[model samples]
Target chain A: QKEVEQDPGPLSVPEGAIVSLNCTYSNSAFQYFMWYRQYSRKGPELLMYTYSSGNKEDGRFTAQVDKSSKYISLFIRDSQPSDSATYLCASAANRGSTLGRLYFGRGTQLTVWP
Target chain B: NAGVTQTPKFRILKIGQSMTLQCTQDMNHNYMYWYRQDPGMGLKLIYYSVGAGITDKGEVPNGYNVSRSTTEDFPLRLELAAPSQTSVYFCASSYSMTLKSANEKLFFGSGTQLSVL
Candidate 1:
């Protein structure tokens, strides 16, 4: 199985709607979870990241992780057209042979329409 | 700051032809990586370097090779291009992976789109 799996969603929503992006991993050793935003033809930039499990909120974005289920999520509030982009979920191990390596998901394409 | 820069933004090569994708970073980061993104395949690591003169293979390293001759540059070379190698290549670097701060995140280049025909 792939280390990380995410829905390649071409998810479309109206402006002001709430958007939820999620990913699941098979490796329990993954301790750091991250979410990256990529615009068309542009490389990804870190949006937010959380260590271990729990919730982290930054402005209108919230990142949540559940180590028990190996699930991670990124929620966007009051989604705007500016928020339209591809969201990628990534995870990395804190220690071990894979310390500096990051496992990424296929990414979900989001479009917030007016 | 240029962060990370990749050369030959786009290229087309005939099968069996070889080429090199250039990547340079001004951040002077110790960690550098090359990844390829295919449709719905996410990003697969091709090679990575911890510092100058040191390199290691990642998930998919069959058709590609990399060298880190300096702290600022890491180049990926494809000895024999194949149609399967056609993908968007990205070069990234990070100050560290200690998870100490959000600033220690990977910064990616604009990407090099290569088509092997």
Candidate 2:
């Protein structure tokens, strides 16, 4: 199985709508979860990061992780056109062999229209 | 800070040709990585280096090689390119003060689009 799995969604939404992106991982060693945003023809940039289970919020974006279920999610509230980009979820283990390696899932493409 | 810069923004090569993708970072980060992004394949790590003269393979390392001769540059070379190797390549760097900071964020380069035909 893939270490990380995400729906490659070309999800379209109107401005001010709420956007939710999710991912699941099969690696039990993964302890750190992250969300990255990539614009067309650009590299991915870290948008949100969480250490373990629970939620972390920053402005209009929220990241939630559930270690028990091996699930992670990113929520964007009152989305705007500027928020239109591909969202990628990544996971990393903090232990011996897999220390700095991050596994990423297929990104979901989002378009927020005016 | 020119965080990370990749050269040859776009390139096309016939199968069996060779090329090098250049990446430079001004951040002086100790960790550098090369990844390839394909449609619906996310980003797969090709190679990574922790410091100058030290390199290691990541998930997808075949057909690619990398060198870290300085703290600022990490270059990836494809000696015999194949059609299956065509993809957008990205270079990233990060700094971690300690092992506990393994989750330190990564700074990425714009990208290099390469086509092998």
Candidate 3:
């Protein structure tokens, strides 16, 4: 089984709605979690990052990691049309400089309608 | 800075053809990686390197090889390309600092989309 699993969602939401994207993983060794946003024809950009199991907030984006349940989530508030993109969840272990060799999710394609 | 840069934005290859997907970074990061993103799938780690001349296999390393001859270059090679190797490949780099010490965020390149038939 894949270490990380996420729904390949083409989830659509109206502007101003709150959005929640999630991923579940089977690897208990993963300690670093991150969320990335990728627009069409563009590389994935870092959105949010969290270590261990906790919540980290930056502006309208919030990242939550639950090590106990092996789940991670990204919550977007006050979604806008520009926020429409593919959201990816990634995790990694403590492997020194290769620390960012992330295990990514299939990504959730989100379209924020205006 | 260009951050991470990859050459040959797109390519197509035959079953036995060989090619190199070039990646370079200007951030002076000590860690570099190569990942493949299949359609409707997450990025899979194919190979990685820590500093110059150090390389290791990742989750999906078969049919591919990588060399980090210099601090700035990490090139992936497809010696005998197979259909399964067709996918969008990405190169990423990050600093050597630990996450707890400082943010070891990743910076990625535009990506190289390859199709092997």
TM-score of chain B of each: 0.96, 0.94, 0.95
* Model 1: CA > 4 A from native: A96-99
In candidate 2 the C-alpha lDDT for residue A19 amounts to 96
Provide TM-scores for the models. Answer: 0.97, 0.96, 0.94
DockQ of each: 0.64, 0.58, 0.58
Superposed by TM-score, candidate 2 places the C-alpha of residue B5 at a distance from the truth, in angstroms, of 0.4
Looking at model 1, the pairs that clash are none
DockQ agreement of candidate 3 with the native complex:
0.58
Per-residue CA lDDT of model 3 for B10-104, tens digit only, reads 99999999999999999888889899999999998899888899998888999899999899999999999999998999998888635553266
Off by over 4 Å in 3: A95-101
lDDT by residue for model 2 (B1-117), tens: 678999999999999999999999998798888999987888999998889999999989999999989999999999999999999999998885223442567889999999999
Give one digit per residue, the lDDT tens place, for model 3 in A6-85: 99988999999999999999988888888989998778888888888999999999999989999899999999999999
**Model 3 local distance difference test score:** 0.88
| Evaluation by DockQ, superior candidate among 1 and 2 | 1
> Could you give candidate 2's per-residue lDDT for residues A1-114 as a string of tens digits?
999999999899999999999999999988888899999888899898888789999999999999999999999999999999999999888775343478899999999999
Candidate 3 structure, TM-score to reference? 0.94
Global lDDT of model 1? 0.92
The per-model lDDT (C-alpha) reads 0.92, 0.90, 0.88
Candidate 2: DockQ?
0.58
